[model samples]
Target: MKAVTGLGWGALILTLALAPLLAVDLILIYLLEDTPFRILSTLAMLGCFYLLSTILSLFVDALTGALRSFVHSNIPRLIDTILHGTVSGISLYVVLTLFPSIDLSTLTVMAIVFVHLFGASFWLNRENSKEDVPLELDSIDQQIIHLLRTETIVSCVERIQHDYPNLPKRDILKRVKRISQSNKVTEPFHGR
Candidate 1:
């Protein structure tokens, strides 16, 4: 939990830091090339892209975690890798924009980088999902489980003794037979 909290904080800091750096880089590129506000728009677009991706991943993970009640899965790890690669790529693009010319060849290189990184992330995600889960128990939880078990066992024993004073444990464990039948019950319907 602490590690996750720390990572979340780190991402926030990176995003915050990247915004101004992107802006500065874009501005410098625009100045050198004598371009217009298109660079600012590009920066904003990149920011929104990362922001949307981050939100979507977090929301998906939250929903999945709520449903499954566990995080040991490839899906979350894939989300993390994509986020990491995106941050790295964004930073690299900002730094590289300072060059005199960002030729088509350079962009091809960036595209290749994206594909390779995403592919590796995909493989890691697959491998992570294939892992066997270890069976481990927490002492505190185990203690609580034992207490619940004892309480339920004691209740059943007392109930049987009250119902059958002399019957053996096997005979005391008779089927629960209702003394009287009751009318059918209905819930207030919420119509579809």
Candidate 2:
């Protein structure tokens, strides 16, 4: 629990720390260029792009989660990040390609920057989600799952945290989510 919390806090602080740098970079890019209006326009456009990315990410996460239900596996954090980045890149590229009178000299660099940003944010989100994992649960430990299945989410999560402090929360949570959704495990719960 502490390990997952610490990682989550670190990632949040790191993101807060990066926000100013992103703003500064945009400002510098604007200053180096001759047109001030382009800077403002670019900034607004980027803001819209980010909002789009946020919406797309939520949609993708839900979609991926649903897809994983059938496969009995969650999307790995790294793969999720890359997929979001790819989706964002394609949208930005399409907009750039279609915009008239705008020179796209910086489009490639901007795509790279956006990908890094999205990947970092997704990494942080993935880490934060580890708070509920029960990574150390073994097949033999299924004995106690009787109690866990009856416990509140918070209680069950805390017990798992306390009992398996060294385990990976992501792995634990992934397994728990799978176990909850699976008829194989839930049948007993339903019968009870």
Candidate 3:
């Protein structure tokens, strides 16, 4: 899996964590049935929810990184799932406390979190595992390949990186290596 940056994970987790707050807020607005009070309550609730979600996201990101270093496997996903579940549980408890007559169940909360986490995992994994198709060398790529014949890979990578600051060094190295290997295979077949 492509490693998620702390900021990336933080944003994702914060968004997911807000789901329960939105649900509860809507429920409260409906139950209270007072427009002015609803507006004030919603504003206050949103502020609290935003603050809490930010803190929760940072905690999860730090914990995920720490666990990843220790476990050295796909433990981040497990950590994320557990953290999200805990957040969902806490949110559900708070919602129930505020409105005892609310008809939400623990299972319902779990199901929502599970579905959200599962979908995120599936999407991220799919994106991470996708392989680039063998490139049809464009003019610039061909120029780079030609340069590889006379230049060291490091030199080519440096030159490319200098010219294309947005392109990752590793990607340039991979492309050069792939092009070189393909040339070797074709040269033997073409008697060149």
RMSD of each: 17.1, 12.8, 10.8
Quickly count the clashes in candidate 3.
0
| Worst window of 10 by summed lDDT in candidate 2 | 183-192
lDDT of residue 175 for candidate 2: 55
lDDT of 2 by residue, 55-149 (tens): 77778878877888878765676667767777677656665554444454574447445655666566658775784554665762473355456
**Candidate 1 residue lDDT tens string, 125-187:** 775667544235444323323333334434544565565577566433332111011122222
Between prediction 1 and prediction 3, the one with superior lDDT is 3
Best by TM-score, which number? 2
Model 2: residues with Cα > 4 Å off, grouped in runs: 1-37, 97-101, 106-125, 128-192
Q: In model 2, how large is the Cα lDDT of residue 20?
A: 70
The whole-model lDDT of each prediction reads 0.49, 0.61, 0.59
> Model 3: how far is 17 from its true place, Å?
13
